[model samples]
Target: MTTARIYQRPKNAMQSGRARTDNWVLEFAPSEAKKADPLTGWAGSGDTRDQVRIGFPTQEAAVAYAEREGLAFTLFPAPERKLKLQAYADNFR
Candidate 1:
């Protein structure tokens, strides 16, 4: 199974609530290995294909980027898989 985590930049990291002019960033952490090679030696060292950072002009833009990149949107403490579950749970709910 593959798991992904998403995080948004805090307000203090931005400038005056302006995302375009400020630094609005998002990070995605992969919770699984990329390949099943036992001795390939491709783990950790920031090259494990398990981490990525993206910047945008606004929160909405960052969110759009996350969606486009197929990441789970958590938005700080609501829930880890809230967005992911909500996306599919609507059919059953």
Candidate 2:
């Protein structure tokens, strides 16, 4: 049986905008550990399912898809965002 992980997308550290972060993502867990190629030295795995990612508007939608596909899944809770409230003048202090 294939196992999957469902979680909300995290905000990118390099960007200030929250685009696409609101969607929940379903990703298949790697069946095998990645191995380094002897000649190219690039790390990769034969599990092509690792490259599949499906996005849903809501968490329930993501879970439903996994259940319908008979995939075992683990749902991860979204991380809480903490705002560092600071005034512009505080930067000078």
Candidate 3:
């Protein structure tokens, strides 16, 4: 049985723009723990499903797809957005 997680895309902290944050993403849970490469010291695993991510416009759509595929999934609702109102001059203080 494949397990997956459905959640909304988070806003990137590197940029102010919130584009594409409304979409939901489905990611497969890693089946096995990653092993370090002896030579390059890179972390990797044989489970490739973790590398795939599917995006949907709405949460319901994402859930539907998961159910249709018979995949067990956990849905995590997006956290509420809080805006901090600040003035340009407040930066000096």
Clashes of each: 0, 0, 0
> Which sections of candidate 1 miss by over 4 Å?
1-21, 32-47, 77-93
Ten-residue stretch with the least lDDT total in model 1: 76-85
lDDT at residue 56 of model 2 (Cα atoms): 99
Worst 10 residues of 2 by lDDT: 45-54
lDDT of 1 at 64: 78
Better of 1 and 2 by lDDT: 2
Per-residue accuracy of model 2 over 9-75 as CA lDDT, tens digit each: 9999999999999999999999999999999999998999999999999999999999999999999
C-alpha-based local distance difference test score of model 2: 0.96
TM-score of each: 0.40, 0.89, 0.88
Candidates 1 and 3 compared: the better one by TM-score is: 3
As a whole number from 0 to 100, the lDDT of residue 85 in candidate 3 is 98
Ranking by lDDT: 3, 2, 1
The reply for model 3, stretches above 4 Å from the true place, is 86-93
